[model samples]
Target: MHTAAAVADFHTYPLISALTHLERLPDQLRVQWADGRVSPFHYQWLRDNCPCPQCVYNVTREQVLEIVDVDEDLVALDAHIEQGLLCVRWHGGHTSRFDPGWLRAHAYDDESRAERLAAKPKSQLWDRAFEWPVFDYAALMEDPAALLQWLLALRDSGLTHVRGVPTEPGSLALIAKRISFIRESNFGVLFNVQSKADADSNAYTAFNLPLHSDLPTRELQPGLQFLHCLVNDADGGESIFVDGFAIANALRDEDPEAFRALCEIAVEFRNKDRHSDYRRLAPIIALDALGEVAEIRMANFLRGPFETSVAQMPLLYRAYRRFIAMTRDERFRLVKRLNPGELWCFDNRRTLHARNAFDPASGARHFQGCYIDRDELLSRILVLQR
Candidate 1:
């Protein structure tokens, strides 16, 4: 076996060369990250009520390993790539050879990694808004802490909302000041209400619509979406939301090929309404380029027909089908309603949002919203000290 000194060479290649996603593992359970880093995670749960008899006593065995009983760093060691194999040196100095082929085959391909772990979607419920402080347009114009808190919540609920903002139609422009860059859309806040003249809805499209993202085909899509509700009728017209990141993640786990295909092909998006003229080309599935699910672009209506090289068409079609199936899957969709005076910000890059047609039946439905460049938003969050 090569000495540990020899293994350090593996770090020279891109981290993607060293790391791998073990199909279907749970917890912060990255078996091997692109950086040749390894983290302990057996399943998806973050808190470890580990039921292993060694960690937890079998009721019959009656000997619980108390918190103080276990060595915290379970097994710490560095790894080296030797003879095409990535070997792990256990805390005790013992070593194990990991099948190098298995690691290489899936390197930089998290879909393969997800399959190894067998992760799937469970019924996740998110209805009301988040408990964190919801700020007014003026406060948000100054402080973005509330938005940050809601964003971090994605670790669990995969979605969040900011409620009770005193909406001033002009407030959206100030709100845009916080972001690093803006993705100006043709329709910053276009409206299509429930009217007796409406076509699709047998009943004037009155009910709130299902959850979906704003754009699905832009090669670079808006990373954040903020809507400041300017007016709310005495009755309906609440905003609805679903967590797209979680849904895409669940799909990645259930089918690797489908996941891979989605990443490889770009879906066309077009908006040719009389008032709007816009078009985009992007993948239905997006990644951080580091092999993680970063965003999901799923807009059935916005997507234009596939136009690709003949050789790429069949493969592209296969991927298109996969995306459609997953988007329609109810298990992957979580729903929520947003009330007026409520300012909701969704990770335009990661979350999908929608709203139903409000009933003019009782009152009017109006939302005054604007765009904030994602770069601006992130810069506000990550201003560096150095």
Candidate 2:
């Protein structure tokens, strides 16, 4: 009996016994296991994904066989399980060996596809009771484990607070460089968030700012934002934040039609200045290929004129109003006052941030801010895990 013990020295599927039978179809190969599970593989697919030293470089582990080099009408001349590996000989005088364990892992059947889609990374939505993750700046700089934990928190929760940071100018850039290079925008590498009389952007003023994401006009907006508080002896300028993804997911479950409208309708965002005229059109609620919330892009201040058809205007406005109302609701908003030596790092694409109107005469409020790409944070976490 050809059982799992027959190929115990080689990699084998967990729930599947050694290959009990192989049936070669006209254009595919089917394998049956002792557990009664059947997996099908097309001749072309097996040929394309051959795990051999010749077809795949051993050092780089990359495929050397170009798709164009393969014969379009390729067929498996013979296929059988040998030493727990699926050995296939093509009609083109080529043989490929595939580990059954690898084959089971890479199956493209409906069940496998559904399982993969369901296992995607999901955000931990937060409300008023959500406690912001706080990290020690010194530990993050000196300890790798601390840094990894901080990055993971930022990835899963989309926000964190770092206390005991140096209250110096341009300090935010140093902290951002630990993960990756700082992402510079039209606002420069490190921009100051203080009241300026001649400020072109509303963020540089003491006016009451609404909850919004940054740089929605850019085609690829910055993913992460770091704000370092140097001075905050002001009054009524409390920091406001709302998890856009959380509210978006709620909107999806409660008012699916409204969610659909926001996802389908593209709104224009623009930033006009003496130096540049940046513009782009994107949906407020963006989703990944698997229909999960990937990012949220909404900026009331940067929103340009509506360009959709006149008939679709009502649907778009209704959805837009509903979303904006949810974001502004007190239930979803978190109000905090940042103090000196404290810094905030948050997902620019997932969190909507705001600031209340402050009395500039009461005291000065200054913060230096910078941006970093989200991929850098994710990459660092992966490397640390390995």
Candidate 3:
């Protein structure tokens, strides 16, 4: 029977390993080890990492490692008492353990080595390199399964290329049918046209569009943007792209309050250039009413000025400028030479796509592109991944 003095002294001890086996126990706590030795530890270490609430994974999947197996392991042995304890500690850490007998039974075993590996870091939701069927230009777009697989891969990758596609008028239509939504932009396609017929007009800087989400000032900015390059050759025409979601997440992490300011303040964007065009006003850092982040808006052309109270305007503008810096940073920007028959699609709500002027003198380039709703891509991916 235990005494009050022993119980009090137990708390004073550091729960050292050597003393574990010394604790009196029933006949059930014995086991052998890989090195042919035996040992027995008390319940202390056994309860430490038992996949309990105090452990990880919310104590789920307890059966992944079983404590029951240890019950049959306890036994008597002729092994030395101290070495026996060491053996029990080691074996107990595995699936089972031995008190003393099992150690002598396995006395001829050799030593074993074991260690745990570190966990993996998280990946960007849009980084799809690990998925199946890498983006290759050789694959044909005709096969239904192959076509569907290709489109889904495009969605997962947040980028894709269509090869051998016709470069004529209706090519964009066929391409649009493969995907559900469409984002029609100023030009039928994002072209770096440099043909002699376009001598005076170096492909559009008649424009220097601001870095902004396509239409995020709206409730739903086009989720996807498709750029099908039908031509490529130029001195000044290279497309600039930035992954807006990555930038927004970075800002959110770097300074949550600054991010909060962006999420809270409403900014106005207006451009009635042609065709029933209208403007929208919303937070530069758009979030659904649920507080789930939906999109970002930072535009020189569209967004005009800060509308918040005088006090909040300065803070909001500060975050706005920081966001622009992040988006333009080389770390976040992806510059690519879009060539013919190459179609790239991205989450426009989460990516800001742009282009620089090129001399149309040398030659011409043409690209036909469009947009589709973002959720369509997500819904399709969920269905497929499921």
How many clashing pairs per prediction, in order? 29, 0, 34
Error of 1 at 351 (Å): 0.5
RMSD versus native structure for model 1: 16.2
RMSD per model, one decimal? 16.2, 4.3, 15.5
lDDT of 2 at 228: 92
What are the models' TM-scores? 0.55, 0.88, 0.58
Sorted by TM-score (best first), the order is: 2, 3, 1
Residue 9, candidate 3: C-alpha displacement in angstroms? 64
Better of 2 and 3 by TM-score: 2
Model 3 agreement with the true structure over 1-386: per-residue lDDT tens digits:
11212221111222112222233354433344444334443343342324322232432423343446445444423223453333223333432222222223222223211111112112134321223233434343344556557656555445455556666745766666555645455443333333444333223342434556565445567777766777766565566766566677778899787888888887787655445465687777777664555676756666676678878878987888888887777776666666776666666766677777665556666666567886776665545443
Worst lDDT 10-window in candidate 2: 1-10
Winning model by TM-score: 2
Poorest 10 consecutive residues of model 1 by lDDT?
6-15
